[model samples]
Target: MRLFRSLDYATDADPNWAGSLLADGTLPSFRGGYVGISALRNSDVLTAVSIIAGDVARFPMIVEDKAKETIVPLENVEYLLNTKVNGRLSAYQWRFAMTVNAILTGNSYSRIVRDPLTNEPSMLEFYAPSQTEVDTTDPNHVVYRFTPYNSGYTIVCQQEDVLHWKFFSYDTFTGRSPLLSLGDEIKLQEQGIGTLKSFFGGGLKGSVLKAKGKLSADARKKMREDFERAQSGAASGAPVVVDDTVEYQPLEVDTSVLNLITSNNYSTSQIAKALRVPAYRLAQNSPNQSVKQLSDDYIVNDMPFYFEPITTEAEMKLLDDEQRHKFKIEFDTSKVSGPSVQDVASMKTNGIIVGNEARQKLGMKSIDNPDMNRLESNLNTIWLDQRAAYQAAKAATKGGDAHEGNSHDDNAD
Candidate 1:
């Protein structure tokens, strides 16, 4: 029942150390590596990451057949995937949360609850691993101890039902969090922002106070108080009198002096790259061409890495062998789906895709024709029915010859 606020996996924990904890039956250290997930998320970098993932996951999907390679309209799988991934949340909302969690922690999990009588899956519950312990011997085995999810409840879900979506697992059961990999970049961004706030909040740069002549203790105290008074009244333009003996020198730092701005941009771009988000997603001012390129990268290059893995897992896990061969689970990106007109034409020319199929992409009706298999090489024109054309030509030629022979017989008579 524990609501997991953050990831609590032991990625860098030593084997011997965990063994000692087990021997003593003490809780292992829940030390999140430097820049814990909670802290990083609280910072600004995650805003872009979450938005990128959430934007992509918003497109709910349609189930397809693997063997037949067509879509299923009203299957139980559709209802489960769309209307309810969990009892409380719809598939879209749960999916959006999963996508955000995956990007943030590089890992996300869901438990599959089945009907008691039917033994068919009933709901998918996203549990926080606050009390869940991983079994080292069997990497796939996870022992979940429910805190408040259910009182006095313990459950173990195998590989089949639980969806452990991950990013960059690094040859281990625990997927390596991008936050860990891009730790330095995230720090740079966080520290960079912190430095800016500290500087601006003071409304003054670090400065030195110097006197032309040595002052008495009373004079020093008076000077200090006067300086404080001036700072307090800075907004009101309060005037302060400085004697010839005293001078105030300010220390300033322009960004160019330290390349601070460039460093900030570098850090921002690095985090974006690691999360597979395009810079423009973070509100960067990019050209249309660059935007187009990034959009292409998103759909063609980045999204499939995770989606296909789950889809492939669905084929193996969600269905029986026969159903697995006949059915497939897919995330439809048709919202972002595209190709240039020329490219679409080329696909038709190459027979990679067809006219009616392409038309459906734009929400148009299928072309009207019974001869679906007939080939029409000229894409500029409608699909030609060759058999009908040939039959008409043959009939026209025979009638012309008969008319000429009849005319010659009439002339002889």
Candidate 2:
């Protein structure tokens, strides 16, 4: 929400205090001591010292002799004074290290720019503190503050671009009070969070978007099938022909009639009849003309010309190969639908037309054939024969009784 714009070094009223630490004679003892003055003279060191001193004093120090006596009194001391100075310096150094470490370790604040034209968020810019510029407790190090350039507009950095920073009441320098130095600005720019001008485009803007789901299984399968078909068609060298014969014809009766015949898939006689032209005239005209000329004339004159001549040997071979391939494909497809002839013959001898259509129609179930009518006829024949035999046997049994009665009558005669 908050954006930073420019980075300027923290201003100092007496810049010499920061520079004097570098002089060998300024604090000879402190320079050669365990904690050398030069060691704490760095930008990070000065910033740390200043931060700890707050608004009270510019240089705070403490000196203890080997006898545990105060070597430099707090008030009378000219070069080194109290312990508060060292504490302020140390605190500034510590805080700077922490901030720089966080930035270096990818723990910095970042925001993305949205592209209004694309309606999408662009790239992000991150604020990264530099180790060299970081003085955790340095008061002399330059710290930035957001000031209103205009009455209502605050000048802030929006990813190195001069864009208004939205969603925040104040700028980056106004909130949280993070200590920064001149080196910090350099490091921040180096880490890709410098100024708004350095940013390529105002960072991410627009709207958040989501990706659509993957294609359906059936759609994928269809696409693959189409691809295979197209590859096969290309490999086979099949001619790419568009049937647009009618479009070339003129509006005149002859051309219109000829084009109509040629555009349709019709025989010569059918074409002649449809066009109201005599078949003999077509026959007479065909013998004297080349197929190309005939087709061109038919298309121009609107005549029906279905047959295309094989002009080249390559074309003829390609056509022949395509036809043979199609035939083989169809034959193989049909073979999978039925059993072999041997299986049919074996079933027939067993009084079972296993693959017969009639059996399937009658609902008689069989793995080889599903016909039902034939099964009904077979069952009817078997039942009729059984019934006839039963009747004949019953008649014979009655005949014996009849014969005995007849013999008694003969003796009486």
Candidate 3:
């Protein structure tokens, strides 16, 4: 991996030539267009995106040393990701923004800043997907072209100098947004909302007034004004006293008749399906779901798609070959396990995780006691051989007591 990369200031490479470089092949030379953040206007979209991204951001990323079975913290990368990512964003803010960008736009990019003398990473600078482009013309050395926000110039970077996170992707380079395929559903939902707003705003109330015969324009105008005046404000619930020449007929505009409520619910479910989010996560709750069951389903089914991409890309881009062989980077998923008190106690008693490890998951400080670091079965049934020996010793003690009693009885006779 290249530890140091200088920004290429004098390159004449046109930004238009940028393309995505996949491991197997290349994609079309175009910037993966940015989907507007306005998509959050949809309630379901906002909820789905927030639940996934917020949970992701809440989980901490750590580098684990497989050889030593311990965590090795890198102040540059780990601290930046867990505490502060850059000058402008906190760890949570950075993660949330990047995830939102990836989910909405299908790609997120950040430049890795490294120290000149030590050749260690120092900062991670974020770039909007729209501000970054990839040039895959060279199969061996893929290039990144980044235009800084509100800046007039573009900085050309080597593949090693930037971190790219992608969502669901077919070509492995440019990710496909969930909204891309659900365009019709989103449009219909938005239109439905607009219709509701207009219907209520206009105060139509699904009623039409008819005249007995063709009336003059002046008469029609006066009648409409009088009708609106009577229907609004103080006279809203009162009966309208119209002349015999006019008749009122009520049209069916109930939500059930129009299928408005059901249609909106179906659209929301479709949006959730498209995003691979559980419907309950978007406030579409089912009849009888235990919290534990829902939490497990979320972690097992929905979360891997959101978590693995970022961690895998981070491991590849952040760690060098030697470090990667000895260490791995991952999020501490147990934090979001939503385990009950009984479940957590069982884990401890079974020696699945040590005290400090469990405490870390609970966001508590580690105890300094040696017992806290040890993993021991609370039931004293650790190994099969030990259990067998314990049972044998108990039987021998009982047999000895019986023999003693028999000897005492023989002596008395």
Candidate 4:
């Protein structure tokens, strides 16, 4: 019995031919059939066996039930030995074949691969069997000879649920095939892996986006008009000018009221009422009282005197010395009296009283009357002594014996 089946022969062989061979018990006789036995093992057949053995080696099987038959039952043997075996074989041909199966078949056993940088899912597909050259010039390039049509299958490669894929092409030169290169897919996977790591590792989810708003034109216009109206109203309501004026009246006085007050010596209040003027104003305008002292009697007597408001030259001149002197004498012009000798003598001795009252009132003192004859005698003695001293000084200047004589002369003088 064959340990593994070839997916190419199983899928490509005629179903009727396979059924007829099974019924006729000629299945093993058919080339590349399910139960075929090779004379000398084919390289293709060995390659298939090596792939399945590698899977079993990596994940070994154990027998769970001895009584339930071999752990993988004969009923499940075809599926286990063929379908599952083929699925594992497909991985070596393309990098992301299992990932493709996960996406297409929705198999829980298969998982998507997430790219580290882009964080997207991905898968892979095999190159055609005839293509043998794998472009190795650029690390990131995957040059393949592929027919956009007639491609058999697609493989889904993933890391953490993201899907990725690579399409293959046919090469005219080499009959045997190589992998459709996957460096670009690897780079894409790395990018998606980085992005996924960031998402799970805590960071911003998407690209930055922004927006803004502004006032409408009509709203702005309305606000401006309202402001202008308010300003205008305030300006119009302000006061521009103010009124301020004064009034005057005529002043009057009664002559009869003044005459009546002067004739009867009426009270100051009665006079003010008759004249329609205030009492204080009337009193302020009245003349002050005058008093004179008699020299012979030493008596102070008040006199009825009116201070005629001195307005004329004649009245101003009445206060001058010449006019005052004329008014001072008691003269009878009708009798024509003349000056007496005693009066004339008094006037000749002293011109007039020029001393102030305090000085005139002071009495005579004894110290004021000095001895004039004694004073004259002392003055004569001083003059004689000075004349003698001068004569001696004149003699000494002529180089005479005048020292003794001068002393005698000074003593005598």
**TM-scores for every predicted model:** 0.72, 0.13, 0.77, 0.14
> Tens-digit lDDT track for model 1 on 184-285?
766666676777777677636356679867889999889887777767645533454566777877676675734664345777666667666676676555
Which one is best on lDDT?
3
**Lowest-lDDT window of 10 residues in candidate 3?**
22-31
Candidates 1 and 2 compared: the better one by lDDT is 1
lDDT preference between candidates 2 and 4, better one: 2
lDDT of 4: 0.29
Total clashes in model 2, counting residue pairs 3 or more apart in sequence or in different chains:
51
lDDT of 2: 0.31
Candidate 1 lands at a TM-score of 0.72
For every model shown, the clashing-pair count is: 3, 51, 0, 36
- After superposition, candidate 3 runs with Cα above 4 Å error: 1-34, 67-69, 203-255, 338-413
Residue 307 Cα positional deviation in candidate 2, in Å, after optimal superposition: 28
Write one digit per residue (lDDT tens) for candidate 2, span 1-413.
11222233223332332332222122333223212233233333334323322311221222223232212232322221122113233323332333332211212222233356842333323322210112112343322213322344422333222111111113222111111212333233223322333332322211122223566878666655554454453433334322332112112223454344334323334434433233344443444666655543433333111111101211222123433333211001112224445665556545654344322223223344335223332343445568989888889989998999999999999
State the TM-score for model 3.
0.77
lDDT score at residue 342, model 1, on the 0-100 scale = 69
Of the candidates numbered 3 and 4, which has the greater lDDT value? 3
Deviation in Å, model 3, residue 290 alpha carbon: 2.2
Worst 10 residues of 4 by lDDT: 302-311
